[model samples]
Target: MKSIDPTIVKKKTLIYIPKLNRRQRTIVSTVFAAMLLLAIILGGLLISNERITTNLEIRNLSPSLEHPFGTDWLGRDMFARTIKGLTLSLGVGITAAAFSVLIALALGMLAATMGKRIDALISWLIDLFLSVPHLVSLILIAFTLGGGVKGVVVGVALTHWPSLARVIRAEVMQLRSAEFVGISRQFGKASWWIATRHIFPHLIPQFFVGLVLLFPHAVLHEAAVTFLGFGLSPQQPAIGIILSESMKYLSTGMWWLAFFPGLALLIMVRSFDILGDNLHMLIDPHRGHE
Candidate 1:
């Protein structure tokens, strides 16, 4: 056998490797995070109801290869239940967040373009919504609507829009003063026309990032209300319901009941949080300057 030369080994070790800049890194990470969340959503959707069936014979099994997340006291697979619950939560989150974004878009534009009295009224509405804690508002809305998927969705939609609306309002206010907007107005274009064509187009990136960022909050709030008995029904396979059920068995040494479901929820929320942050970074104009 030939002995390896130290100098040749050192030269090979010194070979240059290019490092990704902040923008490139952000793009790569955003893609990965998106794919991971998509996989979880898809997997949860594809899993059948049979996998989550209760069987007292296998009840309360610990985590193992056969049952990755273990079994609940009723012998339902925790993994399946967690995935299903997450998918349901995702549905609610997406629906609520989309509606919330639409609300923000309309109110934001109205407040900026509809003149002083309208602006003041809209601003006051925004302030009023912002003044109340979201949970308190959400609970009231959900309860008044009679507590189910519809109630939860509408409640979350109504409650989550103020912050994003404020951001959009500020952006539109800034855009209203732009030279192109003034030129458009002078050239016989209506305010609405200038807004939809010029200002709204510029806000697409901001709206998309805001939508993505809102998903986690919507999902979390939905779960919270459900846990508090003001959201989804007990029959629904929601994460909140699962958690509420798990509390009874926790002292009985069935730690897996609460542990796995909560962990999965956190992981899903964190994934969206990362995806939104990276996408915002990727699109930001000042990012490269920094």
Candidate 2:
């Protein structure tokens, strides 16, 4: 037998490793690290009443050794408010995205598996939703529904599903005609069984990608709606509410109240967006190559 070249083998191994570009690596690291730190901070806040209370002094004290984020105009501890707001914003974004993804998955699966009439109806509904401006529709829905966190979540979820539905529908349509799906059908498996077992596995990566991508949008939408005075109540410590309140004090030189929260929000949104892009690349390396 001819001797195999060790150098060529090493080159082949390197080729198979799927090296991430600089941006991809940075995104992955930033997202993973931020998520971990955020989780730790949130947990600490939830568990430590003293720590939480200590941060909630209601005065616009500038950033000092005692008050890191400075006090809000209401003298509420900016640090506590920030931590609380971060938790709320993350909760809203994740919950809304999850609900939207579930809606999309169910509707998309149904459309792909059912008859032409069902598919047509679903398609029409999706088109109708896509035609409307998502943010405007979210605001309108939230306002109509009494304007609170629940309303904002529901509104964001409802408006967010159509695009995800289209993606899921396309994935299902492709899988429905595939060999494995045909094999499942030939084995006398129920449609739901085949969908749940075989099809869903393939769909999950895409679904996850969609979920991550939806996160930044959901967060931004929540902030925007709240800032416009139609989502979260003014009493809530949401970043948008903080920013909105800061407008009056802009001339008074109390800039840290808005600046730190806004910075935190920006970091979070950017982190999630980068994370989504990295996840897409990791899940579909071929797309990265292109």
Candidate 3:
């Protein structure tokens, strides 16, 4: 046989696409995550409670085209119930995480900008909270508040701030020693003026990313405490309540009851986590390189 150039007689290859740059990747992820979250929350909330109302005639139905997630033993549509519960969970997460991020921002700035005594006290409090198990403190706080929506949201807000506070505090401490801040201080600028004009602007991205990151934790904790009966009431369409009730039927081969709701919750949490990560990368481009 005549010899042929190996490069000219190339083998076929599978399809290939170029890798995305950091900005491109971030935009894609952020858009997808934001849309997915928004659609789910809006779709879930827009559905009336009537969809999940009892209908004994359809009780204990399995998954079908009519009832995508099947019907609970009470004949309620599991899909509607899951969506409603997810909406409630989203509310709890948003409220709790916002409060938590605000608390973190305030305490962190104070600890870094204020004198040593204030820093010591705030640091001690941070350490104290960090030393305790999060779930333990959350359960205690929720129980002390009497175990309802208020209790759960408050508990999550209070318990989730310490770690984020520490991060913010360190960031502020570093920012305080920056050349521009020192020059501003030398130019007779007040702490508040410098913070608002310089430091606060820088911290905004951190605050937002921290807030997004906190959502998953808040949602998961709310569901956990509620499932343990230390959070929302059983009558409410809470994810915890749905899962808790499903447990009683799982043994009777009612797998869909638990499986679908649990899966939805997982997807919701994971989506927030993805959104947070993408936002962080967008805010801090250096992280994306890693």
Candidate 4:
């Protein structure tokens, strides 16, 4: 047989479909991830309100075609419950992450632009928040705030901002010394004007990526607090409550109750994580080559 060159084959393959450049790949992945997330979220929301009814005749059934996620002890459709809970979690995650990012942006801007005393205070606050264990702090906050959806949202929002804030502060501090900023200062532009016009625009990419990165953490923490009975009420069809209710039946081989819901939650979290990472790669110029 004639000698076959792997290089020739590789070149031919590249010619047919041309390997996707980093930017193209990043865009593709980001869009796919975003679409998947949206589908899950919207699908969940569409069906969430329709799942309140129960049927005792089908209670406690295992996974089957007729009842994909299985029937809960209350004869509730596990699929519907899981979807509903996921929708709720997604809503909470988005809200909490947005609030956290806003707080971070404000504190970050303040720390970067204000006097050394203010910078020191903000840095100290960031360090203080970072020093505490996240879950413990979250639990404490949720408990103190009278444990519920609102409490979980607030807890997640408050606890997740420090790292992003530090990043923002560093970025702003660097932007402060940029050539254009100096030119603006020489032109007698006020600090507020420079910030609003220059600094904020540059920070948009960072803010978007950071906000996305905060979402999975918010969702997981919300679910955790709920599971611990410090979040949404048991009456609510939340993933945490579903899992909590499933524990009693695990001894009897009713594993699907917890399994399906937990898997769904894991998938949702992972999707958000992938979406954030892809967005980061898409936005960061240095990483664009990769």
- Each model's lDDT comes to 0.91, 0.83, 0.92, 0.90
Ranking by TM-score: 1, 3, 4, 2
Task: Please report, as a residue range, the 10-residue window in candidate 3 with the lowest summed lDDT.
Answer: 7-16
In candidate 4, what are the lDDT values of residues 190-252, reduced to their tens digit? Answer: 989999999999999988899889999999989888998888888888899999989999998
Clashes of each: 0, 3, 0, 0
lDDT of 1 by residue, 42-118 (tens): 98879999988879999989999999989988899999999999999989999999999999989999999999999
- Residue 167 in candidate 4 has what lDDT? 95
Q: Model 4's lDDT to the true fold?
A: 0.90
TM-score for candidate 1, please give it: 0.95
Misplaced by over 4 Å in model 1 are 1-16, 288-290
Using lDDT, give the best candidate's number.
3
How should the candidates be ordered by lDDT, best one leading? 3, 1, 4, 2
lDDT of 2: 0.83
Per-residue C-alpha lDDT of model 2 across residues 139-241, encoded as one tens digit per residue: 9999999989899999999999999899899989999999988988898999889888988888888888889899989999999999999989976667888
Q: Tens-digit lDDT track for model 3 on 1-290?
A: 99977766564444568998867877887888888889888878698888889999999999999999999988999999998998999999999999999999999999988889999999999999999987899999999999999999899999999999999999999999999999999999999998779888899999999999999999999999999999999989999999999999999999999999999999989989999988888678677664
Better of 1 and 4 by TM-score: 1
TM per prediction: 0.95, 0.82, 0.92, 0.92
- Please give the lDDT score at residue 149 for candidate 4: 80
103 Cα displacement, candidate 1 (Å): 0.5
TM-score of 4: 0.92
RMSD after Cα superposition, model 2: 8.0
Worst 10 residues of 4 by lDDT: 45-54
lDDT measured at residue 64 in model 2 versus the true structure, 0 to 100? 87
Model 1 worst lDDT window (10 residues) = 281-290
